[model samples]
Target: MNTSLKALAVFIALAGSAWAEDLQDLPDDTLLGEVVTATENGEEERLLDLMREVQARGLLMFPKPQTCTFSYPDTEFFGNEIFRGAVRWGFGTDLRELAMSQGFCGCIYDLGSLDAFTQERIGKPAQDATTSDFSVFRKYRRSDWSDVNERYQNFQLERCGS
Candidate 1:
């Protein structure tokens, strides 16, 4: 099989597993509907509190940016780190939105995008950190960042049904 076919196989396997897993512990559709109703009813505080509560409960998670190490000596830089970008999202881009805009219906929400949306709804900017001085996930290693990001995506699925 070609590389694209191999990737498709992996995607199928992951999707199948995600579907096969018993998510009985997660909120049902009715609960998710209530949350959506809160969004429409302007219960910002309740929504925010719910978001935080779920995160605290391990049902929601945060996604830190991944980075790679770089080495340079001529410029007096040694083993500095740089962001490597998420699986499909760029530093500030919304991967799920991009995919949906391209007409994909089965894609789940990207945690970065979901977090940014929630923050923006609460009148704060997205994590929006940059390397101009320091990064928000400055203390996080690449592996940790990726793990949290994947969990965050799962949280979106669990809480928001995306």
Candidate 2:
């Protein structure tokens, strides 16, 4: 009986190690898929850990803004010129408000659409005073907006030399 129990413990330990090794061997896309699943399932802690791994691997991509007129409701938007100045000067809330009031564009680095999913789930930004408006804008899915933005950016680049 003691021998059987010892064998069972060894099996469990081996299985756990193997599982962890398999996870480490997974491709970036597979790991990212797990990140999305964790986010969708409201596993915030898991998502954070996975995001850290992704960042550590340098898998994150940040494309430059194709135009200075696009609006990013998910994040604070500032035009190219204003963004440069803000970087050189400061990134105060006052500058962001001024940029928004002037109808300038905002730049948010894409995280494989993870930010959109997070925005949809979180409902409101910390400083936003408005009530949830997602219900009113249910027709336009986040993925749809992403596709439209990608096409628009491509068109803009093709039409004008960027």
The TM-score leader among the candidates is: 2
Q: Clashes in model 1: which pairs?
A: none
The Cα error of candidate 1 at residue 15, in Å, is: 35
lDDT by residue (tens digit), candidate 1, 1-162: 699997986676456435534333445443344345446657686556545434433332333443322222222111233432321233323443343333222324432343454244333333333333233233324345555457556655654455
Give all candidate RMSDs, comma-separated. Answer: 18.5, 17.6
State the lDDT at 31 in candidate 1: 34
Q: Say which candidate scores most in lDDT.
A: 2
Superposed by TM-score, candidate 1 places the C-alpha of residue 162 at a distance from the truth, in angstroms, of 0.9
TM-score of 2: 0.26
Task: Kindly list the per-residue Cα lDDT of model 2 for residues 10-92, writing each as its tens digit.
Answer: 67645544564444444666667767666665768767777765654445545444432223333332223443232212222
After superposition, the stretches of candidate 2 with alpha carbons farther than 4 Å from their true spots are 1-23, 61-162
lDDT scores for all predictions? 0.41, 0.43
lDDT of 1: 0.41
Worst 10 residues of 1 by lDDT: 70-79
